[model samples]
Target: MKLNVAALLALSVPCFAQQDPNAVEAGRLVFRMSCAGCHGLHATGGRGGPDLTRGTYSTGDADKDLFSVISNGVPGTEMPSFRGALEDANISRLVAYVRSLSHAGAVPVKGDRTAGEKLFWGKGSCGQCHRVGMRGTAIGPDLTRAGKQRSLAYLRESVVAPDADLTPGYATIVVVTRDGAKITGVEKGFDNFSARLIDLSGRYYSFLKDDVKSMEREYRSVMPSNYGRMFSANDLDDLLAYLASLGGER
Candidate 1:
């Protein structure tokens, strides 16, 4: 049996990355400027981005695959085409940097994971609004893969200051009807003329601006803001460890 050139190149991505330190460094700069905001400075995932150091990607894993995704971007995703923003050589360097990170280890979490799980379900009361795997409710963002999708720092800030970085579409929406009924929930849809929301009960509602007495989309999180004061520092670290461990094995 013989492997094709493309297969050989893919198999030796790590080797290619190691052979050229200058290119890798250049790529690192490019990644820092263009992708670090979403992917984290270390490519460990940040905000809503996926972890790139996991050695696996939702898109194809070849160098060419990475190049394509960066140049053209993934449809229906936050990823945007960089073809116009960067030159071809820069994209290649970026791919090399990403490949170099394939074997990088996940950041160590200092807290106790078991204790964190307890905090999540017990003291944290997070299960009421958030779902991890199939165990919790759906009122908040599904955290089944949060460990893989967010950075440790991001998670910490989220727990203590929920409004610091609002997850897209999770902003609180308040609507008042002409009859004096008030409705509040996360934003499902919004426009100059209409708004849509889903409450804690998972009920969906849509209303036109003219039909409703008033509608306000507060650019803030509905999650409690006093978690920093509610839990001790150790408790926060424990919870973060558990969260960082999610989807890590994949």
Candidate 2:
């Protein structure tokens, strides 16, 4: 008879420790050993994987569902099956570790999203760098699906502290051409042979290493960092609520 993956997953459920005294540590080890590279060491996100700690993952949050996905892997994605890669006991521990991430950094967002939308497009000046539903510029990261993929904590940190966590490939840069021309922009692409940059004015530039005089990587983000001081407590909360409602189930 054909077996159900969910049923099979359930059979192993009881094998997991009830209190799971060692589950978290074991799982942490499992995550580091097997899942961290792509998912990110902190599970915040990585070049190859979306933030696993947040978002509506292909593998649902249920224990059985998570187990099946980890063991069988999601189809049409880089997440490969670990059924043979990890022992069943370790897989159980891995699940516990992943589950803990959800609570590690919870965002306490509360406010009116409707008013927040007005603030985002009008007073906030957020549309200049970020995009939402094809309405804003593409200078910065898009917020169209941010709510679905990002945790409230991440979103909150992004606004008030723009430079706190610069997304990969979006770091600000200053490049000096061999001709003594100084050009600055956020990095849009990079490889061993070349680099691509896009300025705040929507201008794009690509340069070969040999063609440039110098390249200075700036740790500070171009996005304004005084939002925490500009907006009131309620305003910040409202803005977070608005961004958080942008994606996930319409």
Please give the lDDT score at residue 250 for candidate 1. 34
**Which lDDT tens digits does candidate 1 get at residues 93-169?**
78888988876664567999999999999998999889888788887888887775677778888899999999888
Off by over 4 Å in 1: 1-15, 41-45, 50-107, 248-250
How high is each candidate's TM-score? 0.72, 0.65
* Best model number under TM-score: 1
Write down the TM-score for model 1.
0.72
Cα miss at 211, model 1 (Å)? 2.3
How many pairs in model 2 have backbone atoms within 3 A of each other, for residues 3 or more apart or on separate chains, i.e. clashes? 0
Q: Once model 2 is optimally superposed onto the true structure by TM-score, how far is the C-alpha of residue 204 displaced, in angstroms?
A: 1.2
Question: Which candidate leads the pack in lDDT?
Answer: 1
Give the Cα-based TM-score of candidate 2 against the true structure: 0.65
